[model samples]
Target: MSTTQTQMRREIEEIPTAVDRLLSTSAGAIETAISKIGNDVPFLMSVARGSSDHACAFLKYACELELGLPMASVGPSVASIYGAKLRVPNAVCISVSQSGKSPDIVELTRAITEGGATSVAITNDATSPLANTATATLPICAGPELSVAATKTFVTSLVAGLWLLAEFKQDQELVKAIRALPEHLEKAIACDWTVAANAITGQSVLTLGRGPSFAISNEAALKFKETCQIHAESYSSAEVMHGPVSIVERGFPVIGFAASDAAEDSLIEVADALTEKGALAFVTSKKAKKAICLPHQRTDHWLTDPISTIVSFYTMVEKVSTARNINPDAPRHLNKVTETV
Candidate 1:
C-alpha cells in the first residue's frame, strides 16, 4: 500500500481548522445574516444539491427544533427549468453551496428573493453568483479544497449554517458548543473506526440514523459510493425496521450513527436488532446490547455531537478508499464544483 497521504485525507484532517476559521472569521457575517431575517419571519426554505443539500437537511432539523420554524427545501429546477414563480414573502431562504456558482442555485435564490423572501447564501465563495444573488452571504471559510470528495467544506458549511441558526435564536448554550467545536472536532478526527472500516468487505452496506444524525447518515452513504465504490444506503431508524430490514443478512455490514440525543436509544435498538439478525452492526453509542460500539466523540451539546460523527466518518471512509486501491482525491466522474442548471 502507498504511504503517501491523499488530498482527501489532508482535507479531512483540516476539518477542525476549517471550522475554526469559519467561526472566527465569519462571526460578523453570521450576525449580518441574522439581522436580515428579522423577527417576524414565517418559515424557512432550503436550496442546494448533493452534500450541500445534506448540510441544509441538518439545518432543517436545527431550525425546527431550536427556532420552532418549519424548513422546506425548494427545488432549484422550479425556477431554472420550469420558470415557476415563488411567493414566500414572510419566509427566509438559506441556500448552501460550497462553490456558490451553481446556475440552478443562483437562479432559484434570485427568484425567491424577488418573490419577497429574505435570502441567505452559505458558501465558501462570497464572490460567486449565488452569493451575489442572495440578500446576505455567510462565507464558510473552509479555504481551498482540492479533493473531489468534500471534507473540510462540508464540515465548515455545517458549522456556518448551525452557527447562523444558533445566533438567530440567541441560544447561548448551543453557541458555546459551536465555539468549542474546533477542539471537539479535533478529537473526532482521531476516533478509531477500524471495526467499521474492516466491515466493508462486500459491495453493499447499510447505515442508520435518526433526527439530525440522519443527515450525516445520508452524507455517509454518498461518500461510500463516491469514494469507495460501495453501494451504501441510509435510512431512519424507525423507517428501516419497516421494509429495509428485509435486506439484512448474516455478516452484513450495518453502521448506526447515534448521537447523545432523545433518539439515541431508539437508534441503538435498531442496531442491536440488526445484530441479532447476524449482521455485523456497529453503533456510536455505548448502550448497545448486541451491536458493537465504535469509538465516537461527543460534544457538550447533543445537536453538535452528530456533526462530530461525520468527521470520524470521513477518516474511516478515506482509509476504506485507500485499502481498496482507489484514489479518493479524484473520483471517477466528479468535479470540484458542479454548476448544474
Candidate 2:
C-alpha cells in the first residue's frame, strides 16, 4: 500500500481520541476566543475554500441557533486575489484551513483583521501564516494528513468549530452533546461501504441535500472525485431540480443528506421527487439512516451535518474505491499536498 493509504487508514482509526484530547486541552482557548466577540456582532462571517468552505456553512448554522447569532459565509472573493470584494465588520470572522496556506484563506484573515473585525482562524497547521495573523486561533489538531483529500482534518474542524460555538455561548448542553462525537464517528468508520458503491458502479453518483446538508453533499462528492476518481456530483436540492435533474437515471446512486435544520422540509419534498423519478435515494438521520421519516433535530445546520455526512461519505468513498481496486488515499496525478493558484 502507498504511504498515503496508510496515513488515511491510521487517521480513520486514531481521530476519535485526537478529538477528545484536543477538546480537553483547548477548552481554555475556546473560552477565550468566544469572550472576545461582542453582542453587536450581528452574525458570524466565515472565509474559506474547498472543504473548509463547506465546513463554514455548517458553522454558520451553529452560530445562529447555538449562539443566537446570525451568520454568513464571506464571498471569499475579498480573500482571494481574483474575485469580487466585500467585507463584514463588528462581526466575528473565522477562516478554516488545513494548511493555513491557501492564498484566499491567508488574505481573508488579514483583510478581516485590518477591517477591524474580530479575526479568528481554525487550522491544523500551528505555525502557518493564518495562525500568526488571527487575533485568536483554534488548532484543529487533526495531526498530519498526508492525503490530498481531507478526512480527519475536516471532521476535527467540525468538532473544533462546534466547540467554538458552545464556548462563546457557554452552552453546556451542546458542549456535552459534542463529547459523543468520537463515538458517533467510530460507528461511521465501521460502516459497510461496498454495497453502496456497487449500487452506482461505473455510473455517475449524485450527492444531494439542502441548507447545511448542501455543504455536506459538496464534501462527500469531493472525497469521491478526489479519492476514488469517480464522476460524482453535488447539488443543492432546489437547484438540482432546476437543471441538474436531467442527469439522474435509475442506475445512478443518489445520496441524500437532510439535516435537522431550517431547510429540512424542503429536502423532504426533494427526496419525494427523487422517488418519483425511480432513483433510489438514501437519506441519513442522526441515528444512522433509519429515520428518514423523522423531523430534523434542530435549526442548527452545522450541528447536524457532520453527524450524517461523515458516515455517508465514509460509506460512499469506500464503496467506489474498493470496487475499482483503487486506494482512496492515493489517487493519480495528486500528492498529499498541493500549492496551486
Candidate 3:
C-alpha cells in the first residue's frame, strides 16, 4: 500500500472531528426539531436514499430500541412520482439528504409535511430546498465531502439522526455516548481490518448484522460496491440462515458486524456457523469461537458501537480500493450530487 491517501481516506479520518463539530454546532437545530416533535408522536417515518437511507435505517433501530417508538422509511417516490397523499397525522418525518438537492426527497418531504407530519430535514446543505421545505433542518456538519463515495457525510448523518432521537427521548445515557463518539471513532479509524480486506479478493462477499448493526452491514456492502467495485450483499443474521447460506462455498468471504447489544451473541454464532460451512468468516465480537475476530473499538453505548464499526470499515474499504488500484474518490458513473426526480 502506498503511503499516500485518497479523498475517501481523508474523509474517513475526518469522521471523528466531523462528529465533534456536529455535536458542538447542531445542538440548536436538534433542539428545535425535538421541540416540534414533542414526545407524543405515534410513530416515525424516514426519507432518504443511498448512504443516507442506511443512516435512517440505523436510526430506525435506535428509535425503536431507545424510545420504544416504531419507525419506517417512507419511499420518496410515493409523493414524487405517484403524488399520493398518505395519512401520517401527528407523526415525525425525518428526511436525510447530504446534498439536499434531490427533487424526490424535497418533494416528498414537502408532501409529508403538508400531510401533518412534523418533518425534520438532515442535510449538509442547510440552505437547500429540502432544508427550507421541512419543519426544521439539522445540518450534518460533516464539512465538504469531496469523495463521490460518502464517508464523513454518512457518519455525520448518523450522528445527527441519533443525536436528535436521543435528545427527544431525553436519554442522557445515549446522549453521553453520542458526545463520546469522537474519541471512540478515532480509535475505530486506527483499527486494522487488513485481514478482512485481504479475504475480499473474490468478486462477491456477504456482510451480516442484526438490529442496528444490520444497518451498518447494509452501508458497508454499499461502500464495497461504490469504492472497491465489488459485489457485496448484506443480510440480517436472522434472515441469512433461511436461504442465503446456500451460496456459502469454500473460502467465501463473510463479514459479520456485531455490537455490544442483545443481538451480539446471535450474530457471533451465525458468523461462526458460516465458518463451519467452509467460508472465511470474520466478526467484530471477540466472543467468536470459529470466525476470525477483527479488532473493533467499542463505544460507551451499544447504539454508538456500530457507528465506530463503520469508521473502521471505511478505512478497510479504502485499503481494498487501494489494493485494487481503483480511485475511490471518483467512482465510475457516479457524481457527487445525484439529483433524482
Candidate 4:
C-alpha cells in the first residue's frame, strides 16, 4: 500500500495486528538502529506539526510511563515562533511526519542534532527530507492514506510509539501485550457508534482528562472535528476548572476517560463533576475495551488507554460516517498527503 491508500468499505479489523508490526520492527532493531541511541542520549523528546504532533504527544506520555524517561515535545515553532530553544545536549529527538518532509520538522531535527542529540525519524517515507537527516528511521506500514483527515496512520503511529518504548525498556510483559493488538483491532472494528452519534452528531463535544488521558481526549476531539465536521475540543480536568468552567452547559457530550488506575480517582471525580454540570460521560475500562487493551495497562498506567481508545474511536468514526453515507475514504476539504510546513 502506497501512502495514498484509503479503503471505503466497512470492515472489522483487530488492532493487535498493527501493534504486532510495531513490536516486531522496533524490537528487531533493539540491538541495532532502534536502541543504539541510548549510547548518546539519556532522555527522549519529539517534534511534529498537526497529526504528527499529536503522535509525539502520545510518544512522550508512553516513554515516560513505560521507561521512566523524561520527555517533551519541542513545539514546531519553538525555534521559529518564539525563538525558544531546545536545550537537550544528549537527547533523542523522534520526529513524526507522514511524508517525512515537513520543513518545520526538518528544521527542528536540524536544531536537535546541532544541540548534540540523536534523532530518529518515524515517518512513512525513508527518503523524505526529515528522514534524510535522521540518524535512523522508523517507517509506518499504514500504506498510502488518501483522506485529508488522518485515520490509520495516526493509530499506527501510536502503536509504533508504544512498541518503541518497549524496546528501550525491554519490557517483555508490555511487548507481549502489544502482540495482542491485531485481535483487539479486529474486535474494535465491531464497535457500534450509534450512541456516540446520538450524543455528538449535531452538538459540540468536549473530551476532558489529565496527563496521557488528556492527550487521548485531544486525539478524540481531533478525529471528531476532522471526520464528522463537528465542534469538539479537549481540556485537562484541572485546566477546565480554572477557566473553561463557564462554557459547560446542558446537552454537551463530555467524554471522560475514567479508566481504573492512578488517575482513576481524579478522572472519576471529573466525570462526577461533569455530571454535576449536566454532561454525559461514557467511560471504558481496559477490560471493558478488552480487544484493544495492551498489557501493564493497570489503573496506575492508564496512558495505554489511548492506544486502544484511538483504535476504538477511529472504528466508530468510520461506522458513523458510513451510516450517514459520508464517504470516510474522502472528506469534503482534504487530500491523501498534506504538504504543510
Candidate 5:
C-alpha cells in the first residue's frame, strides 16, 4: 500500500499549497497585528498546547533572533486551572491552535486580553471562540485536515507565525524567503529519505536538533509515536550530550535535523559522535563525516530551512508508519480534535 492512498499522506502533500494559501490570504491580518504591535512592546507571551505549543517553540526562537524580543510560554492553567490573573502589561500574546475551540486556550486568551496584553490568535478556524476573544486573528487557511495526525495545519501555523514575525521586523530578506517557501517545500516533499526510514530497527530512537529545528525534532518524535507507534525521544543537540547520549547503543537509530544555521556544525558534531559510538545516525547536513547524510532542501534563510526539512520528514514518517502496518490517518486512542480545559 502506497502512502498516497491515506488521508495523512494527502495532507502531507498539501503542505506547500496550504502554506501558499496562508501567505496569500493572511496578509491583511498579519499586517494589522504587526502595525498594532509597534516597536515598544516590552515582552511577548505564547499560549498553546500539543502541536500548537511546538509552533510556539519555533516562534519563540524566531522572535528572539529576528526581533530581539524575549518570549515566554504562558501556561493556560494560570487562568483555566488556577484562576490567577496574570499582570503582563505592554506584552503581546500570541496563541496558536488548529481548531481554535480548546477551552483552556480560549479562556487564557480572554484572560490575557483582560490583563492588558494585546492578544493574537493564529488558528485555522477564524470563527472559533479563540478568534472571537483575541484582539487580532490570523487564520492559517489550511482548509480541512481529515487526518487525526496533523500535517498541513502544523506547517501552516509555523508559516503564519514566521510571516508575522518577518512583517513585524521589516526584514525584506526573510520576507522574500517566506514568499519563496512554496517552491522550496515542493522540492522538500520530493526529497527521498528512505535510507533513514530503513535505518529504524524498532528500538528506541532519538531525534536531535538545535534552535528552530529543535522544535521540528520534537514534532517529528511525536509523529513517530502517533503514526508508527515507535518509541522516539527528542533532545537538543547540546542537551543530548549532557545525559541522553548514554542510552545510545550500537545500531540504535538517531536522526539529526540540521538547518543552515550557526548550530548546524554543532548538530553535525553530535551526529558524528553518535555514529562513532556505532549508532545508525543520520543527519541532514552534508558536512557529517561519520553519520549518513540525508538529503534536505535548503531555503534562502535559515529560519525557513527547517520548514522544508520537516516537510521531507513528514513524507518519510508516513512511509514508515505504513510499512509498520499502522494506519497513518487514524492512530490508536487519538482524535482529529482534542478539546481540553
Candidate 6:
C-alpha cells in the first residue's frame, strides 16, 4: 500500500490546513491571554510530556530568545506526585497537551493556576479538564487526529505556542511570518528528502539541531522511533561533539536540521565534520561541504523554518516506514492518548 493511504500520512498531510485553522480561529483567545499576562511577566514555566513536551521545548527557546524572558520546564510531579505548590508570582505557566485529559497535566495546570501563576492551555480539546483549569486556552484546532502517533496536533501546538509568544513580544515581523506559515508548510510538504531516507542503512541514527531546531530534532527522533521503528537519538549541535560523537562510525547515518539563523553555520559545520569522519550525514542547509544537502523550504522567520522542516521529515519518514513493511499508523505497543499520573 502507498504511504499516502495510511492514517499517519493523511494526518501529516493535514498539518498545513490544521495550522491555518489554528491561526484563524485562535487569535482572539491568544490575544486575550496576552492581555491577561500583560507585558511585565518575569519568567515562564512549561508543563507537558511526550510530543506535546517537545512543542513546549520549542516554545521555551522562542520565549527566551524573542521575549528575553527566562523559561524553564517544570516537572508535573511537583504537583501531582509531591503535592508541592510552586510560588511563581508574576509568571505565566504554559501547559501543552494534544489530549487535554492527561491526569498529571491537568493536576499540575490546576496547581499552578491556584499558586498565583497565569495558566495557559494549548490543547485540541477546549472543554477538557486542563482547559477548564487554565486562566486561558489556545485550542490547537487540529481536528480529530485518528493516527496513534501525533502529527497535525504536534505541529499545531507548536504554532499556537509560538503565536502566543509572538503576540506577547509584539514582534510584527515574526507575527507576519507566522501568519504566512501554512503556505510555507504546503511547500515544505512537497520537499523530498529521499536521499536521506535511502541512507538510513543502520539500525540507529542521530538527529542534530541547534537552538529552536534542537526541539525539532527531539520531535524527529521520537517520530523515528514511533513511526519508523528506528532507534534515533537527538542532540544539540554544540553538545554532540562533547560526548555523543564518540559513537559515530564510518557510514553511520546522521540528519542535521539547520535553519537560517545565527546557529545555522555552526550546525552545518558539525554536519560537515561528521561527514568528513566518513559518516553518511545529511543536512538541511546549502552550506554543507561534505554532508549531503537535503531540500528544505525556508520561511521569513527563523523560528518558523523548523516547523516546515519537520513537516518534510514527516513526509519522508512515512515513506520510509511503509517501505520497510511497517504500518506508520499503528506502531508496536502504542496508543493515541496516554494518560499518566
Clashes of each: 0, 2, 0, 22, 0, 0
Expressed as tens digits, the lDDT of each residue in 57-171 for candidate 5 is: 9999999999898999999998999998888777999999999999999999999998888899999999999999998999999999999888899999999999998988889
Q: Judged by TM-score, which candidate is best?
A: 1
Off by over 4 Å in 2: 1-6, 75-87, 260-266, 285-305
* Candidate lDDT (C-alpha), each: 0.93, 0.71, 0.94, 0.66, 0.92, 0.92
**Model 4 C-alpha lDDT per residue in residues 1-341, reported as the tens digit of each score:** 23322363322242355456655665544345565575545788888877777888878877887777888777767654555556677688888887886677887787787787878888867678987887777776666655566666777777676767776677777766666666656565555645655666554787776666667778778777766677788888777767776677776677665444476566656666766777655555443221112222231124455666666667666665655556666778866665555
lDDT of 2 by residue, 1-341 (tens): 33344445666666677777677777777877877777677767788877888788878767776767877777555556664444566778888988988776777678777777888889998789889988888898877887566777887888888888776777777777787666666656665544455676664788887765777888888888877777889998889888888876765577778765667667767766775786766665443332133222232324644554565466557556656767766788876655433
TM-score of each prediction: 0.99, 0.86, 0.98, 0.83, 0.98, 0.98
**RMSD per model, one decimal:** 0.7, 3.9, 0.9, 5.0, 1.1, 1.1
Please report how far candidate 3 places residue 98 from its true position, in Å: 0.4
Candidate 1 CA-lDDT value: 0.93
Q: Lowest-lDDT window of 10 residues in candidate 1? A: 30-39
lDDT of 5 at 321: 91
lDDT of candidate 6 over 1-341, digit per residue (tens): 55358998888889999999999888899988988895578899999999999999999999999988989999998898999988888789999998899999999999888888999999999999999999999999999998888999999999999999998878999999999999999999999999988988667999999999999999999999998899999999999999999999998999999999999999999999998888899999999988999999999999899999999999999888888888988899998888999
Q: Evaluate residue 182 in candidate 4 and report its C-alpha lDDT on the 0 to 100 scale.
A: 65
Which residue pairs clash within candidate 5?
A: none
* CA error at residue 3 for candidate 6, angstroms: 6.3
Using TM-score as the measure, name the better of candidate 2 and candidate 5: 5
How many residue pairs clash in model 2? Answer: 2
- The CA root-mean-square deviation of candidate 3, after full C-alpha superposition on the true structure, stands at 0.9
The regions of model 1 sitting more than 4 angstroms off are none
What is the lDDT, from 0 to 100, of the residue 196 in candidate 6? 88
For residues 220-253, write the lDDT of model 3, one tens digit per residue.
9999999889999999999999999999999999
